[model samples]
Target: MSQDLPTTSYALLGLLSFGDDLSGYELKQRADRTLRFYWVSPAMSQVYTELARLTKLGLVRAREDTTAPTRSTRRFQITAAGRRDLQRWLSSATVEFPALKHPIALRLLMGHLAGPETSVTLLEDYLGLLAERRAELQAVRDSLIVDPHSPVDRFRYPRMVADWGLDYYESERAMVVELIRRVAATDT
Candidate 1:
């Protein structure tokens, strides 16, 4: 990888380093299952495109599969240089401050144009969605708990990421509920 590769490139390298060679299709599936929730998840085309670039740069090795005469596919593994680059990127950190582009927050900012009733409804709907997301996270957590050998139990890092997401949803839920009450109070 070059010195100026985008984080998405590095994100793919990180996935490739995770201990198995994956075809472009499997990489996309794994990324959707894991990284899409917290980090950059490339689309299928992006995955194949990046794989091509990485192969050209010698950061990854791709082996062609000729099983089907009609279609040829490649499975990729991170090269030693790729692992080194990812390690260097990881060891040096420039923290990303969490930035939110929440539409409800945007609506609330201009809520005065419509009045507290509009803001209240917006908050209520947003709160419902947050609740639903929290429920889904809870389901994942419960599944992890039931299976003693789950990834979260064995890997401390995955648990930390999951905890941060769960906490974020919980905090947002509480904050929105408070905003709803405060907005409704003006009429009382």
Candidate 2:
């Protein structure tokens, strides 16, 4: 069953496992808030399409929410089958190395043409942007609830992942600073 669905489908199932009956719009919002840090957040249209496919596969159950003040809205929750499939995929899937697509690195490789000044400027600008992103991710890390007394903290893993992202950003910032210095020292 897992082989039939794309990875995004599994991502949605994982989102729903948090125990909220969410509409497609809400799902997109959640993805934007969380997935953007580490993974590509699926477009709104993709969210709807995946939801429809999951519904057809009996992995998700959609029901009309009549309590809405305006027109009825459809909210979705993961079915038992979805949970089983997610668990199976998590346990059995072979993890692949993360693909790096660093635009800055690509540009830096051809820095001879752009000259040292341009390369220094590029690396400096990246530092500012990295700081901004790091702060935003830090805010997200701060917002997660971690209860030490509880044997099971649903947010424990999320907090760990957020910390990992924060560390990654810090490492990138240090590397960019070094690159800036190196470029500025270049003869050309």
lDDT of each: 0.81, 0.89
Q: What TM-score, to 2 decimals, does candidate 1 have?
A: 0.80
Query: Considering every candidate listed, which one attains the maximal TM-score?
Result: 2
lDDT of 1 by residue, 1-188 (tens): 37657778889998888778899999998787667657757988999998998888889999887887899888899999989888888888576785556788888889879799888988898888888877766655555443465654443566577778899898988888888888999868
What TM-score, over all chains together, does every model reach? 0.80, 0.93
lDDT of 1: 0.81
Give Cα distance to truth, residue 9, candidate 2, Å: 1.4
lDDT of 2 by residue, 1-188 (tens): 64657788999899999889999999999998888888788999999999999999889999999997989999999999999998998897779787678888898999978889888888888888899989999989998978788788889899999999999999989888887877887854
The Cα error of candidate 1 at residue 45, in Å, is: 3.5
Provide the lowest-lDDT 10-residue window in model 1.
146-155
